[model samples]
Target: MSCMKTAENVCSTGIRIKDKKLTWKRSWQKYKYLYFLILPGLVYLIIFRYIPMYGLAIAFQDFTVFGGVFGSPFAGLKNFKTLMSNTLFWQAFVNTIRISGLKLIFAFPAPIVFALLLNEIFHPKYRRVVQTISYLPHFVSWVVLAGLLDVFINSSNGVLIMLLKSLKFNPPNIMTSNTWFVPMLIVTDIYKNVGYSSIVYLAAISSIDLGLYESAVIDGASRFRQVWHITIPSMLPIICILLIFNLGNILDGGFSQIFVLYNSLVYRTADIIDTYVYRVGIVSSDYSIGAAAQFFKSLIGMFLIIGANYTVRLFDQKGLW
Candidate 1:
């Protein structure tokens, strides 16, 4: 009887395994084209992203170009200790948090507001024109934009400065001022990204059922009331998800933008982890310390992502998980 019972269990397990294999085979057949389409992206990630992750081992070593990763002497936590004690590293860390926080507060909402306003424009052609114009700045390289802004703000004959002078207001070079530099970064970041960011919100807006609006209309709801009550609620999940994503990247601090736009005069406020790493690691050839700093940042970012996702879930909302 025991042997018969064991035989029955094995047969059931085999059947389940067979079912799973058949289900997977059907799914593969259905999505084979989609998989093929994503193959190049997978290859790119494998080559450029995953492969390069092997260099992370340098964080644990006294890395030297002559010795290479495997040949370098294992220094354990010495590099991390050095990084933690560095005043410049701490300053960069603080600047990264402050800049990223300011951006989160101001720049994050700009796109949502812009999307709401853009949705109010009923004329399709005019809406398209505005969207095209807004998206233009996002496509412009930060290098080019930074150069243009430098000319517009730093040149003695800059139009902005010239206008201020003409009005009898002697405006100093705002870019160099620590107080003004961060604000400039925030404004420029919003200007560059708001349009592109709004595309996602607009998509969310489109996905909202029209019936909700119609019902609100039937209930004598004003457009603002309808939007506040219906559209905003519909977008909450997406907003939460994006907020979590942004929190995960809180340490990034817009490296490309800041690196190009900042000068020595504004380094006090503008220097961030990425720039610090570039200076210390690439320029100063302290590769081990830089790697340790980066590894630390990545570790913190991973925790932030997990925490953010957990918080989002706690609110009974969908999360990245």
Candidate 2:
């Protein structure tokens, strides 16, 4: 009787497993096209993002081109220790924090404010024209934009310099000046990205129920009050999500922009982790140190993302979890 009961239970479990497989197979068949649509993106992420993560192990090893990642001798935390002791690395780290913080404080909100202002515009044509003009800069390559900036602000022959000279005002060489380099970076970054970034906020704003605004109007709430109470509150989730994402990228510090714009004269102000890593890793061929820097940056970014998400959750706000 015991043996018979055991056989019956095994049979039932087997049947349940088969049923689940069949259900999964049917669902896959139904949504095969959707899966197919995402396959390319999945492949790209796997190939470019996930596969490259394996190379990060080099940070723990004395990596050499001929020795390769597998053949490299393990150094454990030696590279990271070296990085910590290096004054240049610390300077770059501090500069990255300062520049990224400045951008977060100033550039991050430019898009939101721009989007809100645009939403208030009654003229659709004019709004589109403004958006198009603003977005055009984002499509321009940083290399090209940097060159344009150099020309436009050239201390000797720049259009800005000429204009300032006309007014009997001396215009400093902004591109080389440590005092102006960071501010220039922030302003240019905001100018380039504000339009593209605002699109998400605009979409968020559009999804807000018009009935809320109408109800507010009926309650004699002013436009500012309605926006403050309804629009901002409605967009808070997205805003929080974006803020968390930005926090994760705190160390990035606009590598492409800085690389193209900065020279030795401005490295004091403009040098960042990415640029420093590129110089140490690729240019200097110190692969382990470079990898260590990147690994450190990634670690900090992960902690920041987790911290930001937890902080948001504490406020009873939705996070990227």
Candidate 3:
């Protein structure tokens, strides 16, 4: 009986080794090309993203450039308390929510609606031209666009400001004014991104079965009716999923646009977490405190993403798990 058990154990070990080898060989045979394709992306994520995550330790310490991440003394929650106590931080927090909320309200639907409008266009050549024109601004750098925006809204010399002045209007510097900061962010963001954003909707629209539209046409449905019932509903799932993802990013605001466009004049209304972090960390060299601020921002983002995903799942089972 002992001899038989030993022989069985040896046989099992041999099978396990064979299975491991076979599995490796099969995987290589089936997906070697795919693995090669993914290798660079994996390396990029590891090097650029994963490696930098080590810096998160700065959030816990009274860190300095000389002190380094581990060399610094722990400050407990003092940085957090300082963050909470600051009136400016609260104001910036409110602005982040308000600005991002407004953008979501207007900008989110703009692309979907624009895509629907464009999809209704029957002329292929004109549609292509419109697509190209609309897409052009998205590729334009925020720095260049900010400069152009400055040209259009310069209080003394911009085209629109000049026009307003001609009309006997005391035009505000829309680019630098507190009252216009959030509005400017939303409008410019929509302008730059709406077409590119609409591309997804366009793809979704184009993928809908042509048969559905034909059947609707046969049923005496007008074009508008078909779009309302057929097109909109067909795109709802993609919209919802994209919306779920977008909600996670709303607090980010437009860091680049806001940073480029804003001055001390609009800082009260325009300061976002990212810009604040940059100012605190790199500009001011308050490494430890900046890390704390950044950590706070990341925590909020994490909650936003999780909460948004949860809400989406509650409303619709098709959600990110």
Please write out the lDDT profile of model 3 over residues 1-321, one tens digit for every residue.
Answer: 225545534544365455454466876885699899999999999989876677877777788677787788888887778778977777777888888889889999999999999998999999999998999999999999988988898878999989988999998767667898778888999999999999989999999999999999999999999999999988987888888777888778878888888888887889887788788778988776677777787777889888887887788646655
The positional error of residue 248 in candidate 1, measured at the CA in angstroms, is 1.0
For model 1 the local lDDT of residue 3 reads: 60
Q: All models: lDDT?
A: 0.89, 0.91, 0.83
Residues 1-321, model 1: lDDT tens digits: 226545534544365455454465865875689799999999999989876577878999999999998899999999999999999899999999999999999999899989889999999899889988899889999998998887788748878888889899988888788888999999999999999999999899989899989989999999999889988888899899999989999999999999888888888888999999999988999999988988989989999999999999999998887
Q: 1-321, model 2: which lDDT tens digit per residue?
A: 225545534544365455454465864875689899999999999999987688999999999999998999999999999999999999999999999999999999999999999999989999889988989899999988888887888888988889999999988899889999899999999989999999999999999999999999999999999999999999898899999999989999999999999999988888999999999999999999999999999999999999999998899997876
lDDT of 3: 0.83
Model 2 ranges off by over 4 Å: 1-47
Q: After superposition, how far is residue 123 of candidate 3 from its true place, in Å?
A: 0.9
TM-score list, all predictions: 0.87, 0.87, 0.86
lDDT of 2 at 218: 100
Candidate 3 TM-score versus the reference: 0.86
